[model samples]
Target: MSSPNELPPAIFLDPWLTAEGDGLKALSQTIAERVERQISSNLSQSARRDAISRRGLVVENLVANLAIMHLSPHLENRDLLAVATAKTKATRYDREDYPKRLLSGVVLAMEELGLLIRHPYAFRERSTTVAPTPDFAATIDRQRVKLSDIGRALGAETIWLNARTGEISFADRTPLKCRIEYQDTEETILLRDQMERINAYLNQSGFRFDGEHQGPVCLRRMFLLRSLSDPHSFNLSGRLFGGWWQELRSDRRHRITIGGERITDLDFQGAFCQLMYVHLTGKPFPGDPYAIEGLEDHRGGAKLAMLTLLSRRGDLKRLSPELKAALPRGWTAKRLMDAFTRHHPALRDAIGKDYGVELMATESRIMVELLLTLKARGIGAMPLHDGVQCAASSGGLVAEAMQEVTERVLSVALPVVEKPVVGQEWGYKEAA
Candidate 1:
């Protein structure tokens, strides 16, 4: 293993280093070994060889261009593939499928050789334009690039790579740059600084530092602290409404007062809020309601909520016509719950009947409608389990419109706590 202090020498551009050259030779040998292994292990060797042959040709052509560029630090999308295919032909590997196989083999080798780094968060925006953010800068510095990161950054987690333009994208979002360049020493320093900055930022944000792992920072815990420290600001209908509600509930440390009733833990409250939101918006909740931490055994509540609003035969007889009209069409109480499970497969096993009773008893048509209207307007809706996710498009009118919707919904929900309690005193009280 290379020491932290040592840097790998630039062997690709070295001329004096013959076949015995350490870096280039090693890279070549590794590529060869990978191709050989792939060819040997393929279920049908003949078909594999044919495919590899064609792919190899393309790769050769591409490499030829790279040779011309002298393996320059960065290769744009078009140039990268072009050069690889050219190299294949120049090397007299004229198979039709050579380019495809060669490029795959090369990428695989580069990864194994540590020549290619994956970024954690690289993505394109909706404007068919790719703009590199501080996060991307940090990622390029880290010597790793994940294609998935590119998708997430653009808010389009599922994008297709364009074959014609060599463009990678999601939801009409295009990348600003196809690839980033990072040579040996540059990557290390960049990653170090980026991580340091991230840690510092987290600390400065008043977030209690917890241990770091391989995922998003423990913002949940930090948000919990923020909620506890400032109950008013963190109240369900206050500034910290919607998505933040789930985090408060999950940790079991946050509480809020609604009317004169002091809600001790936020679990049931969050679930209730989510159901109401779904009922209002006419959109399905993304996850199984039962999967929510404290609600696991109460799938029935979610089911009942779905039935009340979605089922035709549901007890909407008591609700105003305006409210009844908001229910899903052609749905029946019996099948409404099943539909929820079908639409969100991830929640299939988490809930059942007992939950239905709770939902029916506590159904709030007004609140549900309010949540749905906010959602239809593209405002962010925090369901019971999912964290805060942006529903609006990035930038411009769409984003602003959604923000407006969110503010309006918050205005109504937040005031519910301010009204004088009919039979009880208002304000926070200790749990009995």
Candidate 2:
């Protein structure tokens, strides 16, 4: 086996293909032999062999990508199909119905190796139907051990595994040059250094949370320690919209802690509405932005309905299933929109305006300043959509920084919504 000290093939650029290509070839050949043996006699031996080899080649290319998903468990089938099609140059993958066929094949191969188990992933933000295996890291560690033996026999370093996170980085230089549409060139270059710095900070300061939390929940929580995209600023709005933080289930958000201090979440009240009101009228709303005239009892439903209608530009016919499901039983999208419009006339008029984009940019500016200010003071903080979380002891400091940033960016004073202190009474403290 290549020693840990031996540098991996520098050709990780293609990731699916490596400088020492013999190892992948050997692995594919072994899988093909197994698949060929299992084929029914309905196909002739030569035909069966050819089919198995084709399927095996696809499987060999996908192994590394699947292994890397240990860190980002929410990858959808469509995204995987895009990657597979690009990597294998398989024309069949471009078909409209290709995702189901290709993903099922990949799932079957991984299951045969006891590498993955499918779970129902029903997040409102995700359109995909399946979740990555919760045990992806453990499974990949076993594969890495097995592949180490295979590498010893082959006498080459074809696999590049990060033992710490079970993240598999590609060592093939060729395939990586293919362009992806959403690739942010600047963030892509800085990602590695960002991870290293975050890792060092977390390891040195120690991250602590409640022990009663389930393992998978805790795994998601750990995403705060590493970011997938640029953290220097927000994605579109003042909010940091991308990465593991945005995907974390709301109930589990309060579990994060640092240096024995409980973390508290603080956000602006009626975030978008207040911002929009300020933008149009040059003043914040006097009361609840979500308060409907006679339908005050349905504030929560009213708020959601208004946001949905505004976001879709009052296209009630094409309202998403999730939005439709959020309303009361008898309420249709059109009915909800009519009710919200009657009560919020000014907001209704403001709909289809360019204010939302402006709101996001303003909020993003506030967040950038907050983050930079905290970083300058050597304080650790995390961003939620309209709020910031930090060690409970630093709550006052974080709040002051946030207010200062908001006023500086918007030329207005914004209201704050402080979430109750978390992990304080539970006898949990940051690790010493």
What TM-score, computed on C-alpha atoms, does each candidate reach? 0.22, 0.53
Worst 10 residues of 2 by lDDT: 214-223
Kindly state the number of residue pairs that clash in model 2: 14
lDDT (Cα, tens digit) per residue for candidate 2, span 244-300? 334555565566565666677777777778777777787777877777654466666
Q: Where in model 2 is the C-alpha error above 4 Å?
A: 1-83, 87-239, 293-300, 314-319, 420-432
TM-score of 1: 0.22
Q: Write the per-residue lDDT of candidate 1 for residues 135-205, one digit (tens) a residue.
A: 42343335332211110011111111111133434422322222112222453344334333333332232
Question: lDDT of model 2 at residue 413?
Answer: 70
Best by lDDT: 2
lDDT of every model, 2 decimals: 0.30, 0.47
The candidate that wins on TM-score is 2
Q: Global lDDT for candidate 2?
A: 0.47
